[model samples]
Target chain A: MTASSFAFEPWANTHQQRIEQVLSGVLPTDELLPERLHSAMRYAVLGGGKRVRALLCYAAAKLVGTDIIAADTPAAAVELIHAFSLVHDDMPCMDNDDLRRGKPSCHKQFDDATALLVGDALQSLAFEQIAASQAPQALIQVQVLAQATGSRGMCGGQSIDLQSTGQHLSLAALETMHQYKTGALIRAATMLGAYSAASTDHALLMTLDQYSRNMGLAFQVVDDILDATADTQTLGKTAGKDQAQDKSTYVSLLGITEARTLVRKLHDDTMQLLSSYDQAADPLRGIASFICERSF
Target chain B: MTASSFAFEPWANTHQQRIEQVLSGVLPTDELLPERLHSAMRYAVLGGGKRVRALLCYAAAKLVGTDIIAADTPAAAVELIHAFSLVHDDMPCMDNDDLRRGKPSCHKQFDDATALLVGDALQSLAFEQIAASQAPQALIQVQVLAQATGSRGMCGGQSIDLQSTGQHLSLAALETMHQYKTGALIRAATMLGAYSAASTDHALLMTLDQYSRNMGLAFQVVDDILDATADTQTLGKTAGKDQAQDKSTYVSLLGITEARTLVRKLHDDTMQLLSSYDQAADPLRGIASFICERSF
Candidate 1:
């Protein structure tokens, strides 16, 4: 099938289910030792989020002709990192959101201390999953994910955000923040997925990375758009939180119209970047389009 | 030198300086982007602690005839995990201590959010260091460290500690908690160190682990003793905070005399466990004795 003829829904749904299964298999059960921490970790990760990172991973793996099963570990690892970030970001000292994925935040459902440990445990579990993988490049996967998750990546972005709260940011500064905060992991997901295929070349990795960079930015711009326009019920999180906290976002810096324009550009760039590849890259294109067009 | 003749103080001082140097090199400086987070990470990890975990790792590596330079990565990695745990545990929601290693805690020195990010980033950095290692068994090291740090290990033990606060725990239950919390990582340190040696045998790993298990519990038993008997000036932390929090500790459960007795027993067991090994195990014995006899 051609890229345009590819059915994105089935692919997305299948990978989502696959990632959920893998995550469930890897995560400690409530029946395990330290039942409360295990339970809260499950509560935070098992039933929520769009699993977009996992989807990106699977799609990138498919581009390199990797079996869907081969993508499971990295996909699950990236998603765990995502879930841990959300849990910690919602804590009182951070964003302080009570709602996440239409449920009480981890700290709200469990106590703050349990939530803290849950996040910490999940972060380690993510690396553990990668380390335990049978893949030859598992160590590389760990390094990529770790670099993306640590100071120079997601955490760095959040720190910049925290420092910039209640202050205005230039367009460059805003993009820099989101690039580290969201874009780093988004790129990591695709990089990890692509790496799963042993035959994947350096050029393929670079192209996939560029595509993910644009897609990652598009994802954030769309998030800013939805956060400004959608209600809490529709968003499954505390909407307008950025504005409420006086946090500078795409919408705040460039207005909704300009934010939408940026998403369109990023979406176009992402699709064009993948155009050289065959139908195997269709899922990535579809996901990019979805990022640009999704309402909530 | 024979085990009995080993000069632990000078050896420890040298290794301590070595780990600090490695940590300083690995940690991002304040000059890096997201300057504050990098600064806080450096602050949280550098110039602090006994470096007991790194020492254990180096000693274990020595026992396997691994070069000290080869042990650097895993040694730094385990210590990074230790430092990260301290930063998080000292947060307001967990132990809520204002002091760590005789200085203001990370959260106190740089705000709670920075401290939280510092811990999270440090954990990732630890895994990154292991993943980036040139060691062939680096993946195994990652798995070992991640398992020891996750829900079934340090975090689990902390969760149990949080839940057991203000409630008495049986000596068995308390030992189980310490096994996970402290013993797991201590065991991991030796495992990682031993694994750095290409020829380290399973038998060697198992024996070293048993030694670390006793050494770890003895370390905590000593901690409890110090908390009960030493002043803030000596301990360099908030002495009596455990009692103030109504937390269950060895001193609280077994009393000072019994706690000291447990340390002595653990120390004896540790030394006996190493009796089969030659003088290369001297550092391990030295550390065990220090853990047993330390007033701070």
Candidate 2:
């Protein structure tokens, strides 16, 4: 809308605002019983972050020729899962980070136990989002989301990433790790949109999986590059902490320029896949480029 | 059946073995990728507990004339949720317990990150278990479980327990705490059984809820009593840790003798509720008594 290099900004902004409203409306307020846990859930989730998963979900739904409402529930669920994972990952025994999205991490603002419950409860809320939806394929949607986020996918990737920290990781190993960790959920977001459709286009969903995997890897590569080079204020987190902590990252292994090229290459691959579709795929193409290009 | 005081032992033993088989068959083993996380998940779950939740689920289903297969899915799902919560609660930032089920805790056996992922993936798998089931009430089953375990229920209780540590808790406060923390899942265990039926009897479910609430409270009171009096070897965990951590318990506030009477009263209330049901309710009545009376 503002005539930036990206064409998807206005559309993404609309979806972001809509998703935030949905999340706000759905989440129980802190004023209720179990006030502390509810407050922490809201605090952890409502704290600002890029709603990349939601945007992707909306885009995928549009490409599949489905109602936006069909996409909303799964999108919200994916975002909650993301938020919960962040809360757990930032705890004292894990990343131990005190800052997230320019705000105190959940474990910092709330105590560890409260933060732990926040994450746990948010995860249940995520699944409830899908279950509560009136979508025809709601059960399949739950299965897809569950498989993507579970141990063999995102969780498995996290295990590999944790093990690979400070170890000499080959490029192939890094790709596999990101594929499971970030790529799996990103892939799930896209599949959720497709599954939300009354009748999914199997061929198109397969292609979208490719787009998602590439986009997910591109996202992580950009993250590592930003972590290596950006300032804390620019990144809204403690930048360079990965390098400081001796974690092996794309930037650390291949340098920033090469990582940037990889991002562009992945972007081109995603866009090329989108080129075959009609105008409905524009949102996805725009989002693919925007996510790889955006600062946050 | 053995000549034990509980007639459910024959039935309970059957369900327990079946549940163990289901769990063992379903969990991704250590031989697969991300071996440590998988191993820790199995170690934490397969390590051994009384399988009280599974027994309750099966008993509830039997009362409503549902197939055992209908109960197995939810039974395994609830147990997985139980196991996941335990892994996270045992982390250093939470209860800081070192021993669980006579073995090192998840985080102690594996690194913290692996343990965290294990809990997360287990939760996903739990939802997946329910979603993958062919049961007719699969959606309601998920909702029942998600509501029971989420912020307003089990996680909420944990937050209160964390907050109440070292504080002088009123008896009502203590009841509310246990009702949420432990009672919710145990309650879910029963509700899930009721939901798993093809056509649920709402009145019976309502009665079962009362039975579950009283049984859940009685279970917790016995737990507190055992914590104060049982040895760690018998309990398969660090006994008396509650008092060591200054957490309030029924035994702590009421003294062991009074707490025992409360247990008996709750037990009588639960048995009375079961007595009104048909002959099919025998397993539930027997298990309720066994859960209240078992030393472990």
Candidate 3:
């Protein structure tokens, strides 16, 4: 089904409120931190946006029989990482966008220094929160999250993206970049949720890894399509900004039709993988669908 | 013994070589990673700095019964964190300095974007190296290192530093800034080393913590002194840059004489705490002295 056909309006409405409540409690309050840093963090995180990563963490945890309360740390952890990336991406040296989530980007609203510090602070806070969790497996989960977000993962991907500007990239090169930059943490989110429940099925973990890889790429492919087709207002940021910057995207590398087809194939593969699990995997299925169908 | 009399030259020389060697190996040459990212990570980390933090880690671990080779990950981790901080701190929005370690800062030598990515990459690499270590206690040590370097630690301190610039900070506020900015990782270095060796003594850890706190402030106090007394060539980076920017420092707040007295007091206190340990703690004592005596 197309994004328009899904009608997640009511579900999204409830999810947004749940995410807001969790974030407000999870994040250190202004009284506990520098007001400027706290405000910048809240600005990027609490501002209206799809809590896709958080949902993935919660869904994966629930699938593994972990309660939603137990999912809060990982959910907040991924969201913090997401917020940090956005803040840094919007810096003048990177995407240089003035806006994000329909509001002024961190660097634009505050000074670049504040924005940089905010990103740095949020990044550290993510790890701190994860490490400080009372969950029995919190340390292991935190370590996993760190690896997914660190050098061999997301940040490394960003480094590749920065250097890849104006350079021709093979499909393999593009995939490598996305795998490191975006896919790693997305995959880690699911893995973390499973690990949170102390799930120890090696076969299931491998299957989930494969499913996450497909979903991660599918997520990026859809993002590329939306960037090309969506309006700025609809996207809540500058649409086609990637094209404007001449950054290579899946849709640019392959035509929009091919990109869409690839996502469809990826979605199908992911669905097939999920079928091996029971009905408890419904949230994982829903998330994959949501990712494929997101409007912005 | 006085720092001038202690002779840290050999330690400095050996530690420098060790840090470079460890850094060179940490970033895998595997074709899986983008060449540009590998290059940026190398540029940001290799062949830079005095390796003070790395030396501290190695020394502390050695003191606690771990071999220097076994201490490599924590050593590399702290140095990488230091390198990342330097890279970002030199950005136009932060200290805006053009020179670092007597060479062009990363943002100046490479483009600002490359420098930013380099910093980001190095930060991730720090954790990656720690997490990937083969040490028996790798997981726990890595978690400790991450917490110390992240928010509520180094990054938090950086935010406070930026906020406190040009403001009249009280002695306690200044100490808090130093604790977060420089102290967190310094303390972590010692703790990581001890943790790596599986030292579970609560009293010993507390003593090391106290030693680290005093040494951390003493190091910063001496830094302020060196900035005032040393030249640019000798100090490596721009000397007196802090004073030039009207940043609040212990010397600025308490005068050089009082700052000197404070360092002496901290040094004595650190030594007293360590005295409870045996001669195996000589390196720790040496490090504490080295913090006070380093001309630069």
* Candidate chain B TM-scores, in order: 0.97, 0.95, 0.92
Docking class of 1: high
DockQ of candidate 3, scored on C-alphas against the true complex (2 decimals): 0.47
Which of the numbered candidates is closest to the native, going by highest lDDT?
Answer: 1
Candidate structures ordered by TM-score, highest first: 1, 2, 3
User: What's the candidate order when arranged by decreasing lDDT?
Assistant: 1, 2, 3
Model 3, B1-296: lDDT tens digits are 32334456786687779779888888655364656656656776777677878878877776677777888888888888888888899999899999888888888887787777667667766765665565666666656776676656777788888888889899999888888888888888888877777555777677777877777888889998889888999988998888888899888988888878888888778877776666667677888877876632
Q: Order the numbered candidates by DockQ, best leading.
A: 1, 2, 3
The clash tally of candidate 3 reads 1
The total of clashing pairs for model 1 equals 0
Full-model lDDT, candidate 3:
0.78
lDDT of 2 by residue, B1-296 (tens): 22234566787778888999999988998998778778888987884888999888988998889988888889999999999999989988789889999988889888777778888899999999899995788988888788878987888888888888999899999999888889999999998999888889879989889989988898899999999999999998999899899888898899988988888888778877776666688888887778778633
| Candidates, DockQ | 0.89, 0.74, 0.47
Q: Is candidate 1 or candidate 2 better by lDDT?
A: 1
Q: Report iRMS values in order.
A: 0.6, 1.1, 2.7
